[model samples]
Target: MTEPLQHADHLLRAEGLECERDGRTLFSDLSFSIVPGTLTRVEGPNGSGKTTLLRILAGLNDNWSGQVYWCGQPRQKHWDLVRRNVLYLGHRPGIKMLLTPLENLQALVAGRQQVPGRVLGQALEQVGIGPWSHVPCGQLSAGQKRRVALARLLFADEPVWLLDEAFTALDVDAVAAVERLLEDRVRQGGAVVMTTHHEPAMQGMRRIRLGGAGEQGPVTRAVGEVD
Candidate 1:
């Protein structure tokens, strides 16, 4: 894990964004800015392209037409900066089922930074899955697997986060824990953008709906055209 720059003001801006699939328009001319110390929730009905929006911001999807700026520069121009600072946790747990939580976390963070085994253990405990740290993830419950994947957040110091359905499969206590983690991150000047149907109980959060008024173009229109 590359240590992200601390106390840095981060910004992610999308302008004139539009997307289409199977001859249907999902959203168009959607623009928003994610500022430091704030959590922006992306919400909309199903097929509204919430996941696509996150992917576009994370530089994982190029099927859409828009301009994304990281900090004050185009994201494409500072790919290195975005890559090092952004942490994306998708809907599915990315851990290997065959590996134990300890091994999975270690493998995930190995290339980015050198984290001690002790730290990993502590993180697992924080997520309430410490007792199963040695068990193979395949045998873990859905919620447990989710917790195992979430443990990575404890060690991740990234300045920007993009999460998709992070609260799924989590119980009430686990939900509160995850919310606290996001709150702490925002308080520390990190920014977060996530998509979820459940309302986040945290303060100082903003909302952006993908299929809201003036956000989607007619399906007959061109996909990438600005106007």
Candidate 2:
């Protein structure tokens, strides 16, 4: 196997991040570092820059000004290296309606890594969509489609995950399952930075609140707060 670009000690770091949209400043001078084996949740009221922040971290939206580092190196210097290790799951399930769950999974991991068909089937089963693995995603309900998207987590080997409202269409049981999965990832030395309104039940999950009264700047919880 090829060696990883990131190490355990070298985590994600952002310095002096600033963003504005529609003439409104979303955030400025924001900074934070996410260490492996921990979860960082970005919180805020409506219209706050939670989504924008996640996108910036994922290198999806580059309108913001900041320096994002992966393993103490600039992202631009190692874009491919960083992108290979980071998985960005957006607010919507980026699934192709005409394709089956199996097909989607195959396409997603294509060129990155090779997986046997049985593994894909097992991953679908893990997410409770085993029987629908061969069915076109268009027939699945919203919750089911979300589950299909989440199935990526099962076979995903990325060290860092950026989830934006990932739990939106899930039911209570599914939500709990995802929470446990996230916690397990951290326990296994993976890092996650997500934006969600739902309070995470995972222990030691840090928080960043944006856009509140007297809180123009991002309010990051102290490291001591993780426990």
Candidate 3:
């Protein structure tokens, strides 16, 4: 049996995680814990199951067998609660090209936290896309579209963020803005788990590399201490 976590303050925990694709084992026996007010980065070479792990953590791909604990309890038992507090941003923009930036945000907002149009507009402005708020997402450049997708992070009230290659098309300024936003989230007692191949630009972030022949190891404080 896996040892019970010593730090009960963990916001996210995964134990004995296993994932398979096309009848081939991708990764197994993974475990990890994320504490509030911290940033955890998942790093590895290509085809290392970085995105797969993020999906499992976000409760999207449920084909795996393992246990996930949220806020010190079984995630399966409180899936709804976990869902409310977690935001998963994948490589795809996941935005509707036909909708304006504001409309896209309004459509994706969930739970009781409805961001007012003014606030959503402000978030877009912060991302340096205020001028394009009324423009259709399909008309925007790749980087602009990416920024629009990232704007969700600013307005969403979730306590945990899972991002896969979030910095893909961002410029230097946009990258700095994202780093600041994530920093603010951690300072507010929120937790973040992200997958990135490039060296993280954010300070005080913990990094863990994935990908191997055997079962992947659990995320530990040692991995989380990569500053």
Candidate 4:
């Protein structure tokens, strides 16, 4: 007898979500579903609420109205569970300038399972900054700093990845490395959602655009038929 294939779980669902700041609507009536084994890109022009949507997905912006579901349940009903399953990386490379790249990785992964030095070295090599692993991040180039921040993704074991402009300051090789990492995650039944001004390099990914006078509502450009 042959074993049955396991279907990827729906990691996130947003329905009728509305966000506002100081009485100005950022986005409203936004709806989408993200499943494991896929990458969903949120693309739009400047001031179009891409970051706002990412925040809502990450549960960092709780003021929004409507529902966000995780694993088919309301996220609010199980905040801890949702948070544990998701990893959000913002536009800023959240690294301590004083710390070496290896030290920063050590601090971030200290409490979790031990991060092997070989794995850390491999991740740094993937981003083409392996040679500078011992250098303080403040002394590195802007692109190198960005790569150091991105190294956290490799150590994070979450199922969902939320990145805002992840490619910012990345060189060509770094961009390719990031894309490969994302593709590998999807292949292993992980989900990804990100905001980017430029289209991502990954193929078969979904794209959503936010529009309207106040960034109200989203229009799907290209997506998998079911999502």
Question: TM-score for all predictions?
Answer: 0.88, 0.91, 0.88, 0.87
**Model 3, 91: alpha-carbon shift in Å?**
1.3
Could you give candidate 1's per-residue lDDT for residues 1-227 as a string of tens digits? 54544544447888888887776677777777777787888777777788988888889888999888987788998898788778888887579999999999999888766899999999999898888999999999899999998898898977789999999999999999999999998888888898888898878677776653334443211122111
RMSD, each candidate, Å?
5.4, 2.4, 4.8, 3.6
What lDDT score belongs to each candidate, Candidate 1 first? 0.82, 0.83, 0.80, 0.78
Candidate 4 clashes between residue pairs 3 or more apart in a chain or in different chains: none
- What is the lDDT, from 0 to 100, of the residue 180 in candidate 2? 91
Candidate 1 error regions (>4 Å): 1-10, 212-227
Which regions in candidate 3 have their CA more than 4 angstroms from the true location?
1-8, 110-112, 212-222
lDDT of 3 by residue, 157-193 (tens): 7778999999998888888788888888878777889
The lDDT leader among the candidates is: 2
For model 2, the run of ten residues with the poorest summed lDDT: 216-225
User: What lDDT, from 0 to 1, does candidate 2 have?
Assistant: 0.83
Question: Which ranges of candidate 4 are over 4 A from the true structure?
Answer: 1-8, 111-113, 212-227
If both were scored by TM-score, which would come out higher, candidate 3 or candidate 4? 3
Give the Å error, residue 52, model 3. 0.7
lDDT of 4 by residue, 109-152 (tens): 67544788888888787777789999898899888888887987
Better of 1 and 3 by lDDT: 1
Candidate 4 structure lDDT: 0.78
